[model samples]
Target: MKRDERSIRVLLIEDNPGDALLVEEYLEEYILRPDLKHVERFQKAKPLITDGNENYDIILLDLTLPDISKEQLIENIKHLAVEYPVVILTGYSDLEFAVKSLSMGVSDYLVKDTISSLVLYKSVLYSIERHRFIRSLRESEKRYMDLFQLSPAPMWVYDPETNAILDVNEAAINHYGYSKEEFLGMTQSALCVKDSNEDAAEKIEALGSASDRTIQSHRKKNGTIINVEIINNYIYFKACKRVIVLATDVTEKLAHLEAIELQNKQLREIAWMQSHVVRAPVSRLMGIIDLMKTGELDMAEKEQMLDFIFSSAEELDEIIRDISAKSEEAFSDLNKEK
Candidate 1:
């Protein structure tokens, strides 16, 4: 089979054998030979539709069939849970009927007498193409929706002039503690703290000017404030210019930084005490011992001083070791925290 001529399994429901043969001949004569299946009545088509063994790409239905009304036949085929494009083939030339068929979910309508091989091929191709396009659009939309809903950070789009939220994702709704509908109804000003010095108008204008990310604080629903890093850019949606703001809550992160700074200050004080105040007495004792060893005293004084020197030296050694251990431990703790 050619690429475009891959057998398009077609279910043709027409009581007229001549009409069925004509359709088959058209299929074979055309450059695209669609694999055709003939069902003389709606009753016969029902099994093909329900069996699950046969897969038809398109259903060509004749409205004036003996077994069932066009509407009933279409509905019964749909009830079989088979999803394929159906084109209505009718002898009736009533414009109202054609419109009704379209409204009833028929993909296209063709007048039986005017049908040609080119028309048949084109109609099938156009219907299949259209169906594929619609399916693609729906799948793309679903994927976008899933990602938006499952995002870890808050995201929103708003009208800058009114400061009104136009749209918010699921994360935004959860983070702000508001329903999706409620969030959309809220204005940006409402999310700003009452005592905030940040001007809402100025911020909005700045947001419009921003090419990518900006940081700001937002008020939560419970009247608490949160620091948010906002990424904003201009977007044209439905012919309306709007700003899309993607906000990440960083209040906890800021608090963590502050806590780390406090810890660092305390650690510095401990290190200073061990290095200077605690080491000063030990240094003085060492100096006294050095003077005795340099023969700066008489024998009797030296003997008495030797005992003092040894005692002082032992005391200094213990203090020095203790200070060293404490300093090492403090540094290790600091490293762990970092």
Candidate 2:
């Protein structure tokens, strides 16, 4: 819906009847006819504003309410500013206090003697718009905070320059075995297990330019080293440059991959033994049997051929045993890995 065409609900708290009438007339002059509700005392206005049943777009408040002291009124206005935009109406005598109240969370202030319809309309409209923008910004920040805290993967924010941990989530605290207070007290490099590739400065530089991921060794509170894939992104958090990190533990995954590769190497060796070692003895037996079947030898020569056959058979039996033993060993290793 269009902003100007929308209805505005305004609550005016003023004791003087003439001043309240002037405000109602000024709001009526605008094309947008605000549903203006007038109350003479601060006590009466409090329940109307705070009851939740009546939602107000903006509040036009007289700085001199009969039931509320100046100091108490200012305090009340500050609390109301969180829920509604408030514009102060005052005489020239209270002009200084009105001006000061603007800093204390009053959206705007206007002197009643010189107030015009145009000025009042602008103040009310502008205050409501500005308050809406501020509320939206706060809500967006809250949603981001929720996502960061509730994520399953370990997440943390750190200062890029000093490498100091700024904030960490519950997952990060649990995974790293550190309390939130301990994590904040330590630098980012404290969690790192220094090794050949401990180039944290260079990695932080890369992270500042763009989102990146790197594999590194990290140590837990218990001194156990773990492999982690860290994904980093640059962010401006709470008006300061920071880097957010998400860590995934890849220790078990990498170990499983290495085991599979070793199993493949063993299987290849077994296949080679079958093709080369097993083939030699089987071929020798075949040649010796063919010679015996020919029956073309004398008694002594036949006995010699028989000896050759017996020797080839023994060799083939030993080769078969070796192949069986190696096949069993390779399978046993694979099963243990699984």
Candidate 3:
């Protein structure tokens, strides 16, 4: 016969053989198959639990065993089977203790003498399903925690009302140079540079109406300013309103862009000087040469005119050299700092 994947695996800790056989018969009556392991005393059950090889769905305790009985039995079972839902099966039920046991995390309190097959089956099924749901929820929370802590980028969660930081991931601690304890005590405003938090807060609040992504400046723990692209969202967590923040460090990217723009500006200035300032000297030299070619000056005057022409030519050469130096400086200074 093919085994059912949904088959319930149950551990029954009962000292009475008759009661143990009865519980098995009750399980057989149910629609679902239950793999039941019966132990007559707590000692035998202890090793099965401690071995860690066996994974039981639910535990049924008689609350009275030869080696361990009554309150001690409940405590011992709970200590050993932390993940399993514990159902107390006692021949005598004390109403006060039953209520208290349930409050202490016991799944069900059953009176063995009056327990019918249907009631026993239902209780086991219900407790197993409820226990599984709670376990699944814990697993979901762990998955989210792993994603946050193991992320390559910084992330944090904070109280939306007080702006107090609630939790920070490992990535956030490493990137921000702050310990986890220090981060928890600090408020979100501490991270932002003065006057920058306002616009970011407003955008974060707008996330409730619609999503917004913003780039803002923030100061690190060591007072180094950084540019970050922030994306935030409002979430209801643990019965409190909170915001989850994700940031990407873009300080280097912005600096690189600014350098490119500066280089372009310097190049434009050089171009203008080459076209305008150099023309003035060249025009003077042309006019002086024209006078000499027309024989407008005597030999001694021509020597004086040659001096003027030489001066203009030198001025033009200086202008071209300055432009060359400026172009070189612009290119050299643009080396990316990051």
Candidate 4:
């Protein structure tokens, strides 16, 4: 037989020899070749459960055992750290006891006289499947919880309609200078500068309209404002649709970019001025000097013209030097600030 075709292992805890035989016979007749291990008392089952030598998928536990009462027997078996599903086999049809056993984590309760062989097989299958599902759900929830709390960025869940803060992570508490309890009491409006309330509201409205992330400014508890890029989406939390906001502080990054843009603009302006404005006057003086050297006029006129050309050249050179000095000083100040 294939691995899946192999018989299911069952641990039968029954003190009555006749009932044990009946259970064995029922499994043989109705269940498809189940492997059954019979234990006459709860004490005998203890070692098997603790040692983990036997791998049983289900346990058919007699509620009233000679060695231990129904409650005590279930509690002791639980301490053995076995995770197999347990179905209580009760001789009496006690609804209260059945409910109590279920509350104590018993997978299912079966009254021996009432439940047919088919019903018993179905109950066992259903109980095992249900227990597996419950365990899987708990493990998934734990993983999500770990990621939610341990993330580096500030994250929160808030009710969009009521504008109530529902949840916050550790990064938010640290960044905003507020405790998790304090942040819960405050709305998004409370985290905005008084003057920026309208801006904040408009941004929030835009977020609600689109399913994409957005950038906005937020104010901290200490009155310090920060530029944050928030990635928000709608989710159903606690039976209601809410907004999940994952915000990262981008204040310093934006500031650096803006500063770089301003510096580039200033450098372009200086380059334009140097290439056009300062060069034009210097070129004119050089042309005048070349004319003076050719000796194209009288001595007196030539001397006067030469003096005029030299003075003009001196003035042009002074102007160019002044421009260069000013440009260098401005760039130097920028570098110092950097």
Candidate 5:
């Protein structure tokens, strides 16, 4: 039958010719065709094992070799286990040793007397796939650690039960003005400002299973308080459930917003002066001029009306100066921020 999988390359390290032939025949009888390289001595396999010229999916190692001692034989197999999955091919007499080899990193062991084509094929496929999976898991974890350590924003991992900080990144160390050792010895509550601690806890508790994000006041090592937006997610770290946090400082952002609001309030005051206060004096001055133009008053009444007009003019000048001062105050505050 045509095999559905790719051909598996195997290296057989055995001194006995018959045992090597039997293993090859067992694989040939199965539907999975494999490429097998056989060597009779440990010295002959050293070059292939060390040099990267040949890449094999798995190794079928003999429990005994002619040139190497039993202790040295296990040492060699341990080294090979790092590169490829290893299966022990042993006689009945070495069954105990073969079982012990499994603990020394051997993938699987099979007795020469009871081996079948199907069993051999399945062991090869299973060992190779399992090794690939384990290697992939290790690579993924390395990538995650790389990102965590190299992140630009403040990041940390903490245990939720005791609120103890587990791990902290370089950015967090610099931002909080704390050493890594110091951070690890402290709890998350120590970083929070006293006033916000209870409110932050209530918001985190209310989030349930979802990620928690809220703006909070955090105290630094130098007793400087800053506002930060903290976002945390639940994750499994080193087989224990933990929370990972990312904090973004929003202190300057909030200050800028407040300044803009104050400037807006000042501008609103100037607009009120223009619309109501300045208009009142100007309207009075125009009414006094209209009464004088009507010629319905005596000389003394006219003089009194002129005095009222002069008073209204002075009020208008004072209102104009007040509005100009408010406008200057608003722009001056804005310029100082820049």
Candidate 6:
């Protein structure tokens, strides 16, 4: 009945009725009134704790039990306790075993003789709180790893001080043609076509968390060059100051822009030919017509002007043909590009 409606649930694995009753009294006297479950041995406790559905706060495990005890007992229960903190209950003389169990993943050890109601209560609450914090930290780390390692774009972390590669994502391995081990052993310069900024280290120090991005050329393993825009962000990870880099390849995009520019230049040249060369002969023809209208030339001069007009017309026709030819060529080139 006490296990049905308490906040801090605990599992007590001890065969001694005296010790089990003492722990139960200590836990119940606390303001929280922790719900306690008592099991005689590790064998019966396995199903109650390891079902994944039961959410016990902590375990009070005695070193001596009927079915399981001591180091092997801790190991057996640890494999079942996904996140529940196990506090070992031992005699004062078993301090060495208690210390070893602490290193083996037990939360904390309590000596049975000295542990009063208040002391036992405090140890249970503290162990639960500490274990909660530990589990939360590990979950945060796993989430960060998932986001970085599973991304589709190439990304890596490098130490700004030494320019050494710290870690790389799966995308980086496939994109750069380097294995994970090889990338870790290399520096940023290995993939760079140019040593762009010798003062990047100083800049990263000055910028701190507010890192900027820049475009540069990078060399691949097969000796091919690619244009990339690299972004930088600083983070303190694993006791090192590192910069997280994201490289986006822009070589094909740049090539497409260059092609568009060349097409624009060709169109400008055609426009110039139309306005300058094609208009030159038309201007001469207009001037000869004006002379004829003003009657400025007699019969012989008018014949000479007529001959000049014919030559101008012939030149204009040639200029029109040239413009048409160039226009056709430009269109053909554009079609090919498409």
User: Against the true structure, what is every candidate's RMSD?
Assistant: 7.4, 5.1, 5.2, 5.3, 4.6, 5.4
Candidate 6 residue lDDT tens string, 102-202: 87778888999988887887788788889899899889999998889998989999989898999999999999898999899999977787644334323
Query: Between 1 and 4, whose lDDT is larger?
Result: 4
- Candidate 2 positional error at 246, Å: 1.2
Report the alpha-carbon TM-score of model 5 versus the true structure.
0.80
Residue 191, model 6: lDDT of: 75
My TM-score estimates for the predictions, one after another, are: 0.65, 0.82, 0.78, 0.74, 0.80, 0.81
Candidate order by TM-score, decreasing, is 2, 6, 5, 3, 4, 1
Error of 4 at 82 (Å): 11
Number of clashing residue pairs in every model? 0, 0, 0, 0, 0, 0
Q: Model 5: residues >4 Å from true position, as ranges?
A: 1-5, 39-53, 63-83, 90-106, 194-212
Candidate 2's TM-score: 0.82
lDDT tens per residue, model 5, 18-101: 888988888887645678899998899889988999999998888888899888989888888878899988899999999999
In Å, residue 106's CA in model 2 sits off its true spot by 3.6
Which stretches in model 4 have alpha-carbon errors above 4 Å? 1-4, 11-21, 30-56, 65-84, 100-106, 194-212, 221-223, 293-338
lDDT winner between candidates 2 and 6: 2
Please give the lDDT score for candidate 4. Answer: 0.75
What is the C-alpha lDDT profile of model 1 across 101-181, one tens digit per residue? 675556788888899987988888777777667668778978976776677888888887998998888888889888888
lDDT by residue for model 2 over 1-338, one digit each (tens)? 22355689999999999999989888877736578899999999999998999999999999998899999999898999989999999999999999999898889999999899889988998999999998898899889999999999999999989989999999999998999999999888888775323353244334362335576788999888987878888899878989999888867766666566677787788788789987887787788778878878789988887787788778878878887887788778767877
Model 6 global lDDT (CA atoms, 0 to 1): 0.80
Candidate 3 is scored at a TM of: 0.78
Residue 239 local lDDT, model 3: 82
Candidate 1's error at 325, in angstroms? 16
